[model samples]
Target: MTDPNEVDFAHTDAADRKRREKATGLARYIWERDISGAELLDLPDAQLRKLAREAGVNPPSTRETWTVVAELLDEKSRWAAAHPGHPQATPTHSDEKIMWIKRPITPWT
Candidate 1:
């Protein structure tokens, strides 16, 4: 006989895990590409919601896509200001990208 509480807890845990995975995937997508605000605007609401979650914006369910994009960009700018040395903190210009390519890659432990 399984306890109902345990089953509910297990379901909640699974959902949380799934949400985390989606957020991670979205973050990776953003990091690997130079995505513009227009591109983000084209994304579905569900994807924007996931990106909002990853950006720590916590956009309301009733918010429009443009509103969410604005918030995400604002949060990204704040993060870049706070962590200027981080690789993905800001978008690199072509010259900067060349410089980045010339720099040696450090392996993470």
Candidate 2:
């Protein structure tokens, strides 16, 4: 059996990968929904953190634009969950959407 005290670098690596996946997922969701980061900035810090948690990612204690986007998505998700009876409100925000697009989409182009 492996020593209990021995740290598992593999496990740590896996966890890091998971966190990155969650962060990426959160970013994609935000973009698809067209939620505004500025609106997320309007929410309280606790609420912002809540969004990160709901997204299965840990947000930094300090605020950031990506965190704000995650928070906005979480807020909308919570609202939808709370009001299942109500028709889902359009998530499209009037404010400009934050662009977090990854580079090198079309290498051949």
Candidate 3:
């Protein structure tokens, strides 16, 4: 036998929780932050798992970690060794995404 007032309050509380969850470090935030599967580069397997946990992403196994790491490290190496005229290495496809990602708009948006 819940009162109408209590039910309304519970609904409001649930709505607030969802809003915060969506706005927090969700998958979209991780992607837009330029943190991709490519970030495992050069990091040890343990470190990679720890980093993934920190970033709210599920970690991969050693083999997968090495695969991603190799690609990223190769890119970094190529970029570092390239002459001034060489095309700059792109760490991630989304490297420039942060600037263009639309953030949570104000009520005006």
Candidate 3, which ten residues in sequence have the lowest lDDT sum? 22-31
Candidate 3 structure quality by residue, lDDT tens digits, 1-109 = 8776565642476755644443233333344344433443534567646655755655543353345334544444555458545544333345654443335667965
In model 3, the runs with Cα more than 4 Å from the true position are: 1-44, 83-109
TM-score for each of the candidates: 0.35, 0.35, 0.30
lDDT measured at residue 67 in model 1 versus the true structure, 0 to 100: 44
Model 1 residue 20 lDDT?
A: 50
Q: Model 1 has how many clashing residue pairs?
A: 0
- Global lDDT of each candidate: 0.52, 0.56, 0.46
- Candidate 3 accuracy as TM-score: 0.30
Q: Count the backbone clashes (under 3 Å) in each candidate.
A: 0, 0, 0
> After superposition, which runs of candidate 1 have C-alpha atoms over 4 Å from their true positions?
1-11, 36-41, 44-77, 91-109
lDDT of 1 by residue, 1-109 (tens): 8876565642477755654554444444443344544555656777666655655655435434344444455566677779989987756543422321234589999
User: Against the true structure, whose lDDT is highest?
Assistant: 2
Candidate 1: the clashing residue pairs are none
